[model samples]
Target chain A: MKTFLILGGGTGGTMVANKMSHHLDPAEWKIIVVDENENHYYQPGFLFIPFGIYSPADVVKPKRDFYPQNVEFVLSKIEMIEPDQNRVKLEKGKRTITYDTLVIATGSRIAPGETPGLLDNGWHKNVFDFYTIEGATALSRFLKFWKGGRLVLNVAEMPIKCPVAPLEFLFLADWFFHERGIRDDVEIIFATPLPGAFTKPRASSILGDMLEGKNIKIEADFNIMEVDHTQKAIRSYDEREIPFDLLVSIPTNMGSEVIERSGMGDELSFVPTDKHTLRSKKWENVWVIGDAGNTPTSKAGSVAHFMLDVIVENILRQMEGLEPLAKFDGHANCFIESGFDKGILIDFNYDVEPLPGKYPLPGFGPFSLLKESAANHWGKMTFRWVYWNMLLKGEEMPFESQMSMAGKWK
Target chain B: MTNPILENVEFDDDGFMIDPNAWTAEIGEAIAAREELPLTDRHWVVINFARQEFDANDEAPTLRRITKTTDVDTKELYKLFPGGPAKKAAMVAGLGKPTGCI
Candidate 1:
């Protein structure tokens, strides 16, 4: 049987395994998933952990629970990928495995050390990152007793995963502090590298207005240079400074180090992937998924979900000696949680920005697009269940692989 | 309008060129001049790389990507284009403005 090896076993890898398992003949092909950690995290739920909306236990499940019975799950560290010989070497005790085709889903991680003075004694004490479970939990603990000062959420660079997350954090912070009855005491600040509230113009303007409404200040065009521990400030390359009492930093995000060790990645350790094909640019037999690929689209789980069908189709075509289709159009769907039981939905692709409209059904959407509604909030909350149950199983979702402009207006 | 690169050149409100195809290396030099930065061989390396990336991807690249692919580091990017290396690099490279998503 030919082996279909998948790396990381995260959202992208697990989804690929599920979809490929159902598509490929089980008698002729054996699928294997490799990961270092046994627990699969509901990463989107991590955003709620800092606000006490989600506990640590709420977001985690054993990696074994999700994969199909036919697929093999290996728990071990990847020493290096010998892509030249079509084999991967696991850590010392685990045996090396050879594969017919490979999938790289080893996603990005926040590298706090990449920034100067960001990882000092004040790392998690005064400064925290909500991307990880530990950081979120720690911040939750610190925020409980704290009489707040300038609570700053800074995006160190762009193309970070869940780009709307920082804004959502600020929105929730506004709600969280208000709930605690310390709204008057806490001052929230949003410091981003971009010139506006978001990447695109329309979304940026709307989100900017939202920030203004929340009384959370926007420190735009703040290309962070260093964290001044002594001064308790983040200094920009342009010599601008923003002081913060509690610094929630989204540091420089990079891809898996194993890709770096194997010399298969770009400068940020991400596999250089074809934007349309989702295939590795350097290696023909290798495919890249999720945040591991250098696709210009948002590094989001929704993008990975949107990419699932395209990769599965391409893989099966290749198995039959057919040319892979240039099918993917950078479709990304995200629900931005804007606290106080309201949220916003955005549906977009490579050619389109988040336009104003109703989603999925277009005009009849329960979820409003680019505009806040209570239904969007519940949709985001309901997604946690969908993620574990249907999404991982590669069950057909209501959304299509390609974006539709049906309900959207220009 | 502060330091016009050429006559009859229409620019966007943000001061980037209206038409990317209308840009020449001479225009790039003048844009760099507008930022008070003279083109060096190193500067040409970045300009050339950013343009090549735009040709391949349609949109311009982020500062991180350019620094990663080229030998240019983050510190050097700041030294070359003092205020904002990304916007300045895209301006000098004659590519459309750099954009990214979450």
Candidate 2:
């Protein structure tokens, strides 16, 4: 049987395995998934941990539980990927795994050390990140009794996973502190490298207004030079200083180390993939999905989910010696959780910014696009269930792979 | 803000070029002059690098990236471009305002 090797069995890899496993004839092809960890994390749930909304038990599960029995799951650290030879080397000097095809879903990770003084010593008792389980758990414990001062949530650079999360954190913090009867005591500050609250104009203006409404001061265009723990401030490249009593850092995010070691990634370690086709620019046989590839779209789970059909179709076409179709439109649909049981939905692709419209059921959506609603919040909450059940299984979703502007208004 | 060189140019609110192909070196000089930074050899190095990067990636390179790839180190870039070297350099380079990964 021909080996279909997938590296990093996270969201992308697992979903690919789930689809290709059933589609490819078992007698003709064998699917093997290699991941360092055995546990699968519902990463979006990490956002709720600090507010005591979700516990560790709510998010963590065995990785194998999501994968079908037909797929072989191996738990090991990937040492290198030899693209020329069509093989991958594992740690412990194990026999290299050869493959007829390769899929990279290694995903991105928090590299706080990329910044000066971020991890100079042990991280500050005041400084915390919610990107990791440990960080979220620790922050949850810290936020318990903290009579907060300036709670500065700073994003060090761009291309961070779930780009809207930093704003969501501050919004939730507003609701969180108000619920605790200490809203005024907790001065929330959002420091970002972007010129405004978000990347796009309409979304940024709306989100910026929300921040203003919630009494959160936004220190926009703040590119951090260094973190001064002694002074309790972050210095920008322009020498602007934003001080903080509690610093929630969205640090520099980079792709997996294995990508770097393989000499296959960009300066940020994101694989250079054709933005539309989802195929590697350097290799015809290789495919990149999720945060692993440098796609201009928001690096998000929904984006990955949207890419699934395109990748599967293209890979299959490639196997038949046909050219891969340039089908992916960089479609990304996200539920922006603006606390107090309210959320906003954004549906867009490469050409379209998040516009005001109805989605899925256009002009009759239970959820409103770019407008806050309770229904959208419910959708956001329900996504956790959908993520585990439908999304990972590569099941058919209501929306198509390409974004449509059926009911969008200018 | 009122320079004639900048008057007809299509640019965003942050003063980055809306269409990169519309950029000319003369306009780059005018942009640099508007920022109260006279175009020097040092400044052009950063601007050239930024322009080249924007052409390649359709996005301007970060200050850290500029420093790492070019001969000009971090402090030197700050000294030459002063306030926000990367964005300022991008603006002068006739590149669009970079929205990292939206």
Candidate 3:
């Protein structure tokens, strides 16, 4: 029997396992999934946790819940991947497993320690992050009793998962403080390494306008060198400084350490994957999916879902002595939650930038594109249900893997 | 004057025909024409397959299902519809919008 070993039981790995299990014959193939954590987090929902929109229970479940019955699921930390020998070493008991095919889906994580003085005196107390459950929950507690001051939301670096999440947090923060009648007491500031509100120019202008309308300040092009916990300030490499009383920082997000140790990853520990095929550049038998692959796209759950369609189809094709198709177009769509029960949607691919247009249908969209609307907000909320039911099950969604321009305006 | 192709059809906000029964060969051609795609015999094959699948399943068929059942391969499907085959083809076929994670 051919052995298929998948590292990390996150969104990408779980979907691949479940979908591939249905395709490959049990008699000829053995699929095994290895993950260190027992609980699977809906990482997007992490943004809402700090605002008491979703409890910890809503965003987490047993990793086994999403796994297929035929796939063997193992809970263990991967120590290293020896690509040369097609073997993986686990941390516990020094166990090693060999496979005919390997998938690296060990997604990225926040490295708070990478930033100087980030984990010092005010680490979880005043300095916080909403990227993790612990950080979000800690911020939740801090916000409940503490009087508001300068609430600075800083992005330490680029390529963070769900790039819109920090923006969502800031928008939601506006709503949260307004509800508490403390909007006047709080001075909200958004600091990013990017020159504007977002990566895309069109969407950035709209979001920047929204921030301006909300009376929030944007600290554009601020590259942080260190977090000085002593003075409650973040110092940039260029000597620019931004002070804050309560800092919610998205620290440097890096791929799994196992990738770095295995020497199979880039400087950021992300596996160098073919942007289209999602196959590792170095190995024929190896595939990389989700945030683990250094694809030039947003590391969002939606992107993972889109990538899975291509990865699964390519894997099946390769098994049948066919060449894998380079089909993924870096299609990424995101719903930006603005304050006051409104949201905006943006859809783009490798070549096309997001434009103001209707989505799905050209003339009849209930959901507006690149504009804020209540319908888009409902779409954003409804996605949580879609993620747990249709997405994780690896069910075939009606939409194609690629982005469509038929209904969109130029 | 209104384009005769869109004369009698009831389209939703996204320009998809609300009533699948209202679709015809002319409607499909008109939808493709609006998008500046000239429908060849190959385009019809994929469009007919999408409509037939939607009729039976009550939902748009995935790209994988279309490629597996129809003569058009994945690459040819992308060539037929530049960006999104399942979605664009379905629209030209006068079908409802495809749902979930597009």
Candidate 4:
């Protein structure tokens, strides 16, 4: 019998397990998913957490609640991936499980200590990160009753989970401060290593304009060397220091520790993966998805959602002794919350930069692309419902696996 | 734009070789040649601007904005470029060669 082992029952693993469990015959193939934690977080919701838009309760649930009924669910930590041996070691039981196919969906974690003094005395006190539930909950209480002060939003490094989240936090903070009647007193600054507000040209112009208009200060291409928590300041590699009262940091993100133990990952622990096929570069039967894959795309939930079909299709093809289809186009779409009851959506694939377009349908989208509208805001809110229901279950979304460029214009 | 050592030349729509263009022609060409260029030039403005749009707005800016903001018009911008500013800049940036946004 063919045995399939999926590591990390997060977004990628759960969806793929569900899709495979339904398609593969039970008599021939067995599916099992392993994860260290029981909680499944709606990571995108983390952006709203600091703003009190989503409490910890709203973003997390038991991982088992979303697993397919027939699949075996193992709640344990991964000790190592012995790819040559085709086995995975469990940390708790110290047992080894062999598999015909293995999928690594073990996502990333925040590494605040990577920066000097970040995890020191001010670790969760004066400086905070909302990437985790505990951090978000703590920050919410901290932000509450916190009178106006210099609030610096810092990105420790690139390749962090949910790249736009920091920007979203700034936008929401703008709204949050205004709502609190402390907009003027609270100084908001964005310090990033990127030359501009973003990686792409068009959106940067628009969003940069928006940032300037909103009075949020931007420091570009400023590589942070250390956070001097002792002095309440961030010192860039060039010795430029930005003093702050409250530091909302998006710490550096790295993949699972098990990948490092097995010598299968880069310095950041991200698995090197085929951009289209989702297969590990080290092994034939090994696959990886989500934030675990070192693919050059925003580490957002939508990218994982877009990768589901391609990964499942390739996995099935391997079983059939057929060439795996190299079809995933790094498809990523996201909703950008631009304070004041408006948001924007942009959809594109590997080769295509986002264009001004309508989504899901041509010229009739309920959401606007590249242009902020209230409908897009509504769409962003409604996605929480969709994620809990359709996405985790491996149900086919209305959109196609490959990004459609139909509604977009030059 | 032409690179002396890389044997690389800028191209137009028809794949015809072309001359250097843009506010930071020397730097853009240097990037294409795998050489480091100063990041502070206004030449970065277009690529940076385009990347910003691609990230937040997720679309390449129209030729109009790319020209207006970067101080390089469309004819010059599209010459060394292929289709979009992001693709061109990403290739020149050479940071793990973009997987074509797929």
Candidate 5:
């Protein structure tokens, strides 16, 4: 029997297991999924938790809930990936599972300890991060009674998961404070390593203007040198100081520790993956997807959705002894929530910048791109249902695999 | 008065633009006061809304939608400036200083 071993039952691993289970003959092909944890988090919902927009229940689900019957769900930590032997060692079970084809979807996790003094004292106390379930839940409670002072949002380093999440938190905080009638008492500040609000030049320029409009102070090119929990301040490498009553930090993000232990990862533990094929650089039989693969795309859930078809197609090509197709074009789309029941949508790929246009059906789109409207807000809200049903089911979505350039104007 | 959103935009006494790409109420006011180029309501709004959203959120609004929701007619609202709420709003939003263009 041909063994198919899938690592990490996150978005990429789960989807592949579901899709391949139906295609491959069950008798001939045995599919096994291994992970340390049984709980699967709807990671995208983490963006809204701190804002009190989504509760923990909305994002949490059992990993076993999504695995198909044909696929073996083995809950175990990956000890190592012995690519030369075509096997993986599980720590708890102390068993070695051999595979003809191995897929790694062990996603990224937040690393706060990388920065000196970040976790020394103020962690989850005066300082909190919304990237994790625990952090968001704790921050929700902390924000509840925060009478007001300088609330500084710090983006420690780049290539973080859900790049716009920090911005969303800030906007929601504004809305939150405004709703609470304490907008007057609070001060908001954004500190980032990027020169502008975002990575893209145009988006950065626009977002920079927005920051100026809101009266939120911004400190750009501020590389964090250290955090003084006792003093309640952030010290930059350049000796610039920012004192804060509360710190909502976006700490460093790294791939699964297994990749590092296996000696197949870069400095940050992300698997060096071919941007188009989703294949591991060191081995052909091993494939990777989602935040685990070090691709130059936003580490968002939608990127995983966009990459699903490409990864599957490549795997199939390998089975048939053919060249993997160059289908994935780094398509990424996001819903940016502008306060006051309005939101903006942006869809683009590696080659194309976010342009003014409609979405889904191009001209027929009920949603407008780069335009803030109540309808966009509704669309953003409605996506939660679509994600739970359509996306997780391995069903084909209405949009194409690549980003559409239609209905966009220069 | 404690609201940083409503406080006087203290001009950079050192003439050092900490954020060269950053456009603020002071910059917007300077732009309006100079009237070197045509000023529109959309331009004002983009600067205005961006700053507001950024302050509330701690990041700026992406520029992907600057001209999408706004139009040229709203551009004419720049005439009501001088010492007006529209100008104040523009300044607060980081459009630029008023020119008494109206």
Candidate 6:
């Protein structure tokens, strides 16, 4: 029997195992998934936790609950991947597992320690992040009793998971403070390394307008050099300073350390993957999926789901002595929550930029594209149900893997 | 707004016909012309399939369903619609916006 081993039992790993289990016959194949943690987080829900929108229970579950019966679930730390030997070493027992094929789905994580003085005096007290459950929970508590002041939301660097999340947090914060009758007491500021509101130009302008309408200040092109906890300020490399009473930051996001120890990753520990096929550029039998792969796309759940479809198809073809098709188009769509029961949706791919229009249904859409609407806000909320049901189950969805331009305008 | 392809034919904000039933061969040609696509017999096959599917299901057909039931392969479907096959083909065929996680 041929053995297929997958690392990281997160969204990508779990979906790949479930899909492959259905296609590869049990008589001819054995599948295994390894991860260091038992809990599976609905990472997207992390954005709402700070505002008491979703509790910790709503966003987390056992990692084993999502796996198939046929797939072996191993809970252990991966020490290294010896690709040349077709084996992996476990950190716990120093045991080894051999495989005919390997899938690297270990996703990215926030590295708060990477920033100088970020974890200093005000760590988790006044300085916090909504990227993790603990950080989000702590932030929720901090916001409950504390009188509002300068609430600065900063992105330490780029390529963070769910790039739109920080924007969501900012919008939600505006709503949260207003609801508490303290909107006047709070001064909301968004400091980012990017020149504008977002990476894409068209969407950025619309979002920037929304920010202006909300009176949220945008500290554009601010590159942070260090967080001075003593001064309650963030100092940039260029000597620019932004003071804050409460700081909610998205620190540097990096890939799993095991990828680095294995010497199979880039400087940031993300595996270099073919943007089309999702196959590891260095190894024939190795594939990278989700945030773990160094693909030039948004590290969002939607991108992972699209990548899984391509990777699964390519793996099946490769097993039959056929070349993998370059089917993935970097297709990604995101619903940006703008608070006040409104949001915007943006869909695009490697070759296309998002444009204004109605989505799914041309002239009669309930959801608007690149413009704020109540329908999109519901779409964002409804996605949690879709994620747990259709997406994680490896079930087929009505949409195609690639992005479509039919309902959009130039 | 009125579509340039057909007189008195209304288009939505996205340029799709307000009434899909109002679509004709000429409308398809005009839509394709606006998209800068030259329609061929091969393009008709996919468009016709999309229309048939939409009539029965009240929704646009996914690319998987199109390639599985029709002679057109995935690569050829992409070639027919340069950016996105299901979305572009559905638009040209006067179908509603696609539903699902494309």
- lDDT string for model 4 (A1-410, tens) is 87899999988888888888888899998899999899999888877877788888899889999987889998898888899999988977787899999999998899887777888888778889999988888898898888989999998777778766777888999999999999999999999866677767676777788889889999885667788867899987555799999999988788888888889986577898988899997799999889998887878788998998889889889988988885788888989888888898878766777778788898999778888899999999999999999998889788987888789987
Give the local distance difference test score of model 4: 0.79
List residue ranges in candidate 4 displaced over 4 A: B1-102
Task: Please state the error at residue A378 of candidate 6 in Å.
Answer: 0.9
lDDT of 6 by residue, A145-177 (tens): 978899999998777888888888889999999
Give the docking tier of candidate 6. Answer: incorrect
Stretches off by above 4 angstroms in model 3 are: B1-102
Provide the lowest-lDDT 10-residue window in model 5 chain A.
Answer: A201-210
CA lDDT, every prediction? 0.89, 0.88, 0.86, 0.79, 0.77, 0.86
Model 4 chain A: worst 10 consecutive residues (lDDT sum): A193-202
Off by over 4 Å in 2: A121-124, B1-24, B54-59
lDDT score for residue A354 of model 1? 91
Model 2 per-residue lDDT tens digits across residues A1-410? 89888998989999999999878999999999999998999999999999999998999889999889999888899999999999999984585999998999999999999889887543747899899999999899999989878899999988899988898898899999999999978888899988899988888898899899999999987888899888989998778998889999999999999999999998889999998889999998899989999988888899999999999999999989999975899899889899999999998888889989887788999889999999999999999999999999999888888898888888
User: Which candidate, 3 or 6, would have the higher lDDT against the true structure?
Assistant: 6
Worst 10 residues of 1 chain A by lDDT: A265-274
Candidate 2 local lDDT, residue A401: 84
Q: Cα miss at B34, model 4 (Å)?
A: 14
DockQ of each: 0.58, 0.62, 0.01, 0.07, 0.02, 0.01
i-RMS for every candidate: 2.2, 2.1, 15.2, 13.5, 18.2, 15.4
TM-score for candidate 3, please give it: 0.79
Docking class of 1: medium
lDDT for predicted candidate 3 compared with the true structure: 0.86
Cα RMSD (angstroms) for every candidate in the order listed: 2.3, 2.1, 15.6, 9.1, 14.6, 14.7
How close to the true structure is residue A125 of candidate 2, measured as C-alpha lDDT? 74
* lDDT, candidate 1, B17-74, per-residue tens: 8787788888888888876888899888888988888788676777777876889987
lDDT of 4 by residue, B1-102 (tens): 445633454544432223322224444556544434334444466666755655653334544346545667544554445343334555443322332222
Give the TM-score between model 2's chain B and the true chain B: 0.86
